[model samples]
Target: MAFKSEYLAKVYASVEKRNPGEAEFLQAVKEVLTSLEPVVAARPDLVKAGVIDRIVEPERFIQFRVSWVDDNGNVQVNRGFRAQFNSAIGPYKGGLRLHPSVCASVIKFLGFEQIFKNSLTGLPMGGGKGGSDFDPKGKSDGEIMRFCQSFMTELCKHIGADTDVPAGDIGVGGREIGFMFGQYKRLRNEFTGVLTGKGLTYGGSLARTEATGYGLCYFTSEMLKCMKNESFKGKTVVISGSGNVAIYATQKATELGGKVVALSDSNGYIYDKNGINLDVVKQIKEVERARISEYAKRVPGSEYHEGCRGIWSIKCDIALPCATQNELNGDEAQMLVKNGVIAVAEGANMPSTPEAVEVFQKNGVMFGPAKAANAGGVATSGLEMSQNSIRYSWTFEEVDKKLNDIMVNIFHSSYDASKKFGSEGDLVMGANIAGFLKVADAMLAQGIAY
Candidate 1:
């Protein structure tokens, strides 16, 4: 696609020509830049001042080697990366994913998305993300611990409560966060909210684990109320990914009077004619660490379907893509629209493709971009930082109430940003503009670092 802004086109072309084989990172930059064309065009000072160029690139990119001894005394070496993409609003804040899929491109995409997501939260946080190609799915506890320790040995140098705070993503959950924080404390000899998503015994905030999932539904409900004059009451929801986000999204939606019909993982999906029993689902994923297919076996009436892609083919009133990026392509989006899926709120980062998003917008489906819909996790992370600074924790209800307000405020901010930017109903445009303006202004104020 051709860019309307010549400056953005030049930047994209320069990035592509200078860095060969960076397709993933370039694609992420293009998606964001496309949305920002109008914003940059209207505010020529941003482009003239080189704010677009700086925003496209990271402030600092750290790459290090992590060597850890496994339980069997075998040394495993993996790469660790922290892309402190931007720290304009405040410190660099994002998650540390530990999937085998982790790379500079993947981290860039996530961090780029995080910038807007954090902005929507009305929190003082910029965007950044880090992780490794190390897969933790089948690893033992000791092995996971060793890997995290090794990873943190290098990471601790670049991060802090007020500098860059990392949280959990795909593989970096409670267990991973604990191990990483332990290493950081041991090395630095200081206790702080250098990371979010810690175990409750530590500095982690209450309701932090369920914040993203619950927040997604909260934003979705508000969108429904405003657009369709409806709520989650008596609605059927289909969610993908049985991980923290998906599981909790199901729980919150159900609690709000919606019935979750389906949930899936990388392995497959389980469809229950009745609402999925959240307890059983949580037990399987959280305790046993089993595939989602086991949910059907636990319940006699449920059907287990192999392959994650097929979950979208199921019929439902609302759809939450809680899995990975680009999971819902144009074809699956068409399927959802045809199957009477009235609303689509992204629980994962950039789960929908540009084509899929276009289809949803054209069809008038109430679309919530991941930045606006999934800001709950990071917003709560910021709250955790607050607690750490003050040396106190809020009750679960208190944290949840704050999360609810933040999600609602994010909805309003994005909605208002969309209208102001002349794309009233286009959330993609709204999120990018709302997020970019703050970062751009900050970058402009900070000026170029020589």
Candidate 2:
């Protein structure tokens, strides 16, 4: 199958012209569109209807100036962005990340990935993303609150419950969401489902924080089962990013009898032969907001390495790259294969480079792409929407069970699509085609809104 669609060329050209400096977003779009070449070729309606062109570029891109007073009374200004990429199926739904990496390019890349990720979840939610470059790493509560309030002051005007809803990502957690939502409420004077991932008292869903990580493990478990295996029992696991997703993945894996040997952050990783003490790790990360290297000091017989990339060198039966994109490359994939690693499920969007994916597939290692594995966050966000609409709250166990079922179904869908498209074991292709077809058809039916 060759790229026969001239429309793809035009679309890529348009993307290039529109986004000059956003290399990451362009790369993400190119990777996805390259996979959808066959679909675009077979169904010319997508091109004729401008779906491909429109899909590459976001529907709305918002850039606002967020000026807030720090604790020192010095006004700090940072840029805030919200890229509403698509809303064909439903309202704009995604997370609001606050980190030093937050930029138009990063937000666009994340939002572009979210379009297909939400589609694969089989939920009636569109794709969007919002964030700021304000790092919450060492900020005080007052400073964070002021920054979030200022960020939301402008963002509140554009978003709503059924129009565009935002959750939390990276540095934007329950606390950040609370501050943003409170500001929105103060401005608009309405307490609604304008945001997901809020505190339970403020209309957030149960199990939302743990959903992505648990969902990642559940998706990996399903991937293993599809390869004719059991659960993650007795498997040695290595996880990157000691954030919410990694921590929860560790929690679920340990609960399922898998021993997580390593967990890392931007600063470093801590490896414990006896398995990471997740409780202490949680306290250090969640409560104290400390670096992952601190875990070795609290736990005996553990080694700490200061750098995230070093975590990939550890031997494990399962490797969950729960950090950022392109964290794993061909060499790491080869090393994992040589070390007898059986599975690699991405807990972050496009965590593996193209070469890494090729190496893993060539070696027959079970690889779950981020669109399917990391979909739990958005899927649960959709569930949160459902609960909001129904005015009911599900218990943690109930929500978790449903999340597991959804991940299982997503895996089967990818497996079936791969087999149908002559890439039986390659879920990356399966997920791309399946997700693309869903959104493409929907867009076609909706007609050109722009």
Candidate 3:
């Protein structure tokens, strides 16, 4: 169980009372607050200055209606949101997700998590997240373009290169980013780096697509080496989600001598007794835009399950939940623990429930919280912002090397922070306290108005 100080509990109770029914936001607040008991005890000034209260609340939360016409000439309305959670370090930086599940609660949770994730990267990025409840899965290009244009019409007024920079997440991808960037340029009447995950032809950095996944593996490998004197070599891995994060994680893990046995989409998961072939998976997913079940049809000696959760049932040395929030619950954690799983690293924000996290810790599974493990994508985004400012683009190798170094540093900082706080190896508490101290100190220095 997480340790919450008396003051921290009061702040959390206030957060719950103020934001009723926001389960995702409440869960995120609880997770981070519960980890900060020792920090609060050590530094009473944080409580005196109301840092926890102010940090829990966003600086600005914008919600707007996005009305666009579809291919069938029908006007569709969707809800859009941008929760600029913090700006103590720099501009608000996070990804914009486009999915049916996008909401205020989800955006707030992601934004809150981003504050710490961005801080851990040792970059000058504050935390923010924006998205709409618009599903891009079945939409035509024109429809998506129209929706993006309308969405940005409202979004442009609030964002600038030096203000808020949003990248892609979930249903938002290269095509959607292209559309949104084009619209932002048109509306703002300026060509600037207001968004990331751009095409290489424009102001996009190399290796941005693979940053999050590759970073996750790098962080996990460092954690393994530091805690267990092991690496990813010859380990069997299971990854959920067939999106960019999962695909690239599989690629990097395989490159590091790990055998990724399974990958999943929302519909189901595909298991390969042999190692997964990245090329075929990319072809099916990136080129064909099909589901995970299609891999079983094309690849030999592969099996497809009917549900996404069953992928956890496969025995593996490493498990990376790259899917949406709360996708891996307590039962799944128990299953993985029973199957001799040694490590679980999140590639998605808050993918593991509190109960699942407890199970992993109790069973001696080395756990990497999403904020620390998945900070690579935004770290590279910060690099892209730097490149854009200097009008220079680095090669893929250059960006990747920087990203790998950042992940290694993040792991050590978290490990050392945990040790300093007497937790020794609790990355979850270390990440929370390390990131919170950075932001809290900045906020206190800036005064209460921030």
Candidate 4:
């Protein structure tokens, strides 16, 4: 597709020429740049200042090798990456994912998306992301700790509490964060909020674990109520992924009177026609660290399927893709729209493919882009940073209330922007433009060097 703005076309061409073979990064860049057509047209001074071009490029890219000793005394090696995408708003803040899928392209895509996701939170955070190609599955506690320490030994040099803070993603959790934080403190000889998602015993916020999932439902609920004149009450919801984001989204959706009937992992999906039992799910995924298949084994009347992609085929009123990026594609999206799905909100970063997003847009499925939908975890992380700054903590209810308000405010920001931009109900564009405007304005005020 040809860009309507000549400046955007040139910027994209430069990105493609420079980032050849980086399909994920190129895809993310194209999506956001396309959404900014109206903004570019409305503000030509931004073009003169080169805002679009600069925002597409990272301020710094760091890559390093991490070697650690396994339980067998064999040396294991992995690559680490951190793409500090933008700092127009504040220090870089994002998560460090630990999965075999970690690569330059994946890290760049995530960090680029983080630029907008953090902006939507109305928090003083810029965008950054880091991770390793290390697969943590089936690893022993000692092995995990060794790897984290090795990784953080080098990572500590590039990060500080007020500079760049990274939390957890996919295979990373509190265990990983604790290990890394300990390593950072040892290396830096200082203790601070250099990371979020800390354990309660340390400085982690009360609702940090549940923030992303709960915030997803809160945002989706507002989307349904305002866009479709509907609510989660009596609606059937199918949520993908049984990890942190998926589990809490299920709990909140159920509490809001929605019957969450399905959950999934990379292995497969579980469909409990009798409404999901959140306790059983928490036990299997959280406590046992097992797959969704375990939920079927222990729960009566639940069926376990052998493919994660099949989750989207189930009939439902709402769908939340809390799994990995591009987990839901055009065919799966068609299935949902065909099966009477009324709303689709992302709980994972860029979970829906472009073709899938097109399907939702064409069918008027009340789409909520991941930037706006999944800003909760980071919002709470921002809150965690606040608590850490004051050397204090807020009660669970207080954090929960603040998270709710933030989600609500994010909804209105996206909704109002969509309407103002003459694309009412098109949250993908709304979120992209709303987030970019803040960062772009900041860049402009700070001069072209930014």
Report the lDDT tens digits of candidate 2 across residue range 1-450. Answer: 224567777778788898898878887887777777667657777777878777888889999999999898999999999999999888998899888888899999999888888999999988999899989878999999999999999999899999999999888889988899899999998888999998999788999999999999999998887685767999999999999999999999999889999998888888999999989998998999888888888888999988778888899999999988889999988889999998999998788998899899899899899989989989999999999888899999999999999999899888888888777878888888888888888888887875
What pairs collide in candidate 4? Answer: none
Candidate 2 is scored at a TM of 0.97
lDDT of 4: 0.95
TM-scores of the models, in the given order? 0.98, 0.97, 0.99, 0.99
At residue 242, give the lDDT of candidate 4: 94
Better of 1 and 4 by lDDT: 4
1 or 3, which is superior by TM-score? 3
Q: Count the backbone clashes (under 3 Å) in each candidate.
A: 0, 0, 0, 0
In order, candidate lDDTs are 0.90, 0.89, 0.94, 0.95
TM-score of 3: 0.99
Candidate 3 per-residue C-alpha lDDT over 1-450 given as tens digits, one digit per residue, 9 for 90 to 100: 444587888898899899999999999999999889889989999899999999999999999999999998999999999999999999999999999999999999999999999999999999999999999988888999999999999999999999999999998888999999999998778999999999999999999999999999999999999999999998999999999999999999999999999999989999998999889999999998988898999999999999999999999999999998999999999999999999999999999999999999988999999999999999999999999999999999999999999999999989899999999889999999899999999999999776
Worst 10 residues of 2 by lDDT: 1-10
